[model samples]
Target: MKWLHQILFLLLLASAAASCKKFLNVEPADRTGSNSFWKTRQDVEAAVINCYGFLFQKFNDFNSPVIPAVGDMRCGGIGGSIASGQLGQGFYTLSQNDLSNTTNLGVPERYHLNDIDDWGPYFESIANCNITLAEIEKMTTLTDTEKKQYITEVKFVRAFTYFYICRLYGDVPFYTQPYDKTPRPRTSFITIFNTLIAELDAVKDDLPWTATNPSDLGVRACRGSVYTLIAQMNMWLAGFDKANQSKYWKDAAEKCVAVKNSGAFELLPIEETKRIFKGKTKESIFEFELNRNYGNTSLYVNLGQWMTHSPIVDYGGNSDLYFVRPLMERIYPPNLPDKRRDTWFYLPYSNNQTFMFLKQINVADPTGYWSFEDNLMVFRYADVLLLGAEALANLGSNNTEAISMLNTVRTRAGTPLFTAGAEDLKDAVFWERQKELIGEGHRWYDFVRTGRVTDPNQIITPMTQDQFDRGAWTWPIDAKARQNNPEIVLNLYWIR
Candidate 1:
């Protein structure tokens, strides 16, 4: 079955002639080539949906080891033990001098560098966007207004995919064109930021504030979603350039304000925010929707029992695959009247059993077995508010406004509001982000952006280059990709 899936995927990729084929006709019998796929509006739309299919494919399983490999979280199930220690040593053990190739041995985890096969999913999606854009440029079936909207949607998705890659690997090849004969070099951080900003600005006026129809599922990019991406990119850029930090922060702040002003989203009430782990709230701006009926079972087995279950589940017995780090647990506000902790984590009892399992992912099979649902949220309104606060505070314009934004999130979390002035407000916001976004794979990036790894209170311990060399801050490029494309550069930060 796995081989058949691979063969089908290859067939899908090999026939570039049918790249723009309509989703409604995406059956094996209708397996036309990519060249014939983008001639119609329906074809163009299907291409875009195919691009998004990568999100489902890559993140299909929790134990699939994509985000957890790079983030603060560690895995410790029967198969998790090998991967668990690597994340700890990579992120927590500071300094580049102490790590060696031998350090990562015995780890069963697939490093991003080692998993070149995964790269195609991202690039393949980008290819779909490129093909759609080309077809749209020559399209006469749609009105000018419709063309603008379609073009903007494709551009937003293209920018989004590239930006996602940038966050993981500081520099990646920027492929705007569908076909490039010459080898494209890795873009600089500044160039990537400028390009992303240009794309977002160009498309902002074209996208709708929200999708009103069911046919538009994943069709139109929302105003809040683009703003969130823009805000996040700006905040990231600010970290690399301190002298002009305010510009980036202000950019983030403005986009965040746009999201807030739209009133399309709001922080889930304290009780509801606690229910986030259970996947029951409307606070999510965008999440990868998964259903068992869709024939995608990767989420059920990969992230379901492995990440959320303790010894209680048959498949996850005696494994702490999804256990929270001791350092993270310590940072939770003590005596805070919040239910997020109770809802998000499974506090262990005297017999080492969990007191409560996360309810959002709770799924029951017909045979009386249970597992978690695979839907993982990539962006949420709660994150947007915090990003806005951080951007405002970093800009040095409105510390008061930043505090207000931060306070709104805190109040929703049932925690006390922040009272500190500008300097202390930064720490307060930082800690707040740490607490609010834990276990969602944001910590390492947070450390990198804020230079917090050196701060004792932030990381469990400072990491070394020796650790970095073992696929730490930057994920290693797949060795096969380097073999296939010699132009791709390995991360220099890890090179001793």
Candidate 2:
């Protein structure tokens, strides 16, 4: 139970921590904690699992590890009622682009990283990874093969941590050594990204295709997940790495090829979209597993019931906040009747025929008692294919091939095909991604990576192309992230 104790101690430390920046600087519970630990494979396994747990396992808290609200809430796909006087001001400020008034200070009600809700947990998870990697090598209970697998897996997690952090806050404090008490300087976004991609590339060969163990399927990194991340990391850079945009786009296209041919995953048909997040699907490349009988502290799985409710419906959904009717109609076009339109949501004729997310509902447990049992998808084949389509179109890899990939997802949805120039094909793919990945927590990053957010859209924040190009699209490094580390430099343009 030492690992459980470690888990408790880390959670308590995270909750008790004061500022976002300082939140990441986690210290061990006892002087002997690390030295006495990492002596066996179980120790290493437990440690790595805790890294995943602390983020994915959480209930109602401002800092819950479901994808940060600032990422999507600001971009669109939701309509929130004002929670309290000034409590929900930040979200409105973000949504309405009320840039002149800068008087908000919490995390959930206010979707800014300038608050600690997101920054702390991400860094803490990274800290867990640092500790696991630093000591797993010292264990004598495992074979050389085990050592190689464990190290490679944790490195993927670490790189993903940095990658996730960079997408939200731009640049952050980078650390590789765990339990190092020194206050490290915050690294720049560019350097952090370059380092992350380089690290993933270096560890690529070492990580396995899938867990050789039967219990680890779809959850662990396979060459599929590794290359998919490479494709995604490069895509993130394509928009921001101005000087090398072409090179990065090409890299994303080439990297995704391995996942495509790995024979490990396939796109699920629209009829099978219901099975996409059910855990252990051929469609899921990486996901966090949960079972209703067991507690994982994940509250996100309850979203489907909440996002679609009204007095007329019996599923207990919170219908007030949901896909704006006009926008849903605009993007999906009820006339098109795409499978995602027909299947992912329901039109409650009783509630003026409003749209509700029906994707995660367990019909057998209509009251939503088993809602938490669903898996949280991190990466899947649909996303990977879209990544390939986007990158290939951008770099001129082959418009014909890009269209084919784009059409694959379309074929599943029974939507139209792409027959346009490369640039047009790129736009077509972005539009497809928006429709397909909605509510899965990917839109905001897509907006940032592509540098465009329109009003009368889910992302009501009216940002100019200039503002986005200058990194104004990202959140501020809040007081917590800077409180203890004077070494931290703020992204000044974000300051009101």
The CA lDDT of each predicted structure is 0.57, 0.64
What lDDT is reached at residue 494 by model 1? Answer: 48
Spell out the clash pairs found in candidate 2.
Answer: 19-480, 20-480, 21-480, 21-481, 75-459, 76-458, 114-478, 209-222, 305-317, 306-318
TM-score of each: 0.81, 0.82
- lDDT per residue, candidate 1, 1-496, as tens digits? 1122234343444333233323212224354565555467665555555555543455553335455444443212112233455334433222222223423533334433234223555665565566567767887777787788778777777777777677666677676765433455677766887787877887787766666553343324666677777888888888877777888888889988888888777676655533454342446655554445543333232332444544435543443344434542455644565555665556522123233334344443323344444445567777888888888877668988888888888887777778874347777788787667765656667777776765555565455545433445554454444654567777655455
* Each model's total of backbone clashes: 32, 10
RMSD value for candidate 2: 6.0
Position 260, candidate 2: lDDT: 77
Q: After superposition, how far is residue 285 of candidate 2 from its true place, in Å?
A: 1.4
- Candidate 2, residue 354: the lDDT equals 51
List model 2 lDDT by residue over 1-496, tens digit each: 1132255445433333222222222324332344455566765665665555555533223323335354455664355555633225454455544333343433254223233323766666676677677677777898987887778777877787788778867878877876655666778767877777787787787766656665466667667788888888888887777899988888888877667777777877767655666667778877766654443334343445345554324544345356666657756876665888788877622223255776665432434432344566678888988989888888775988788888988998887777775338877888899778876667778877776663334355557777666666666655555665667777677666
TM-score of 2: 0.82
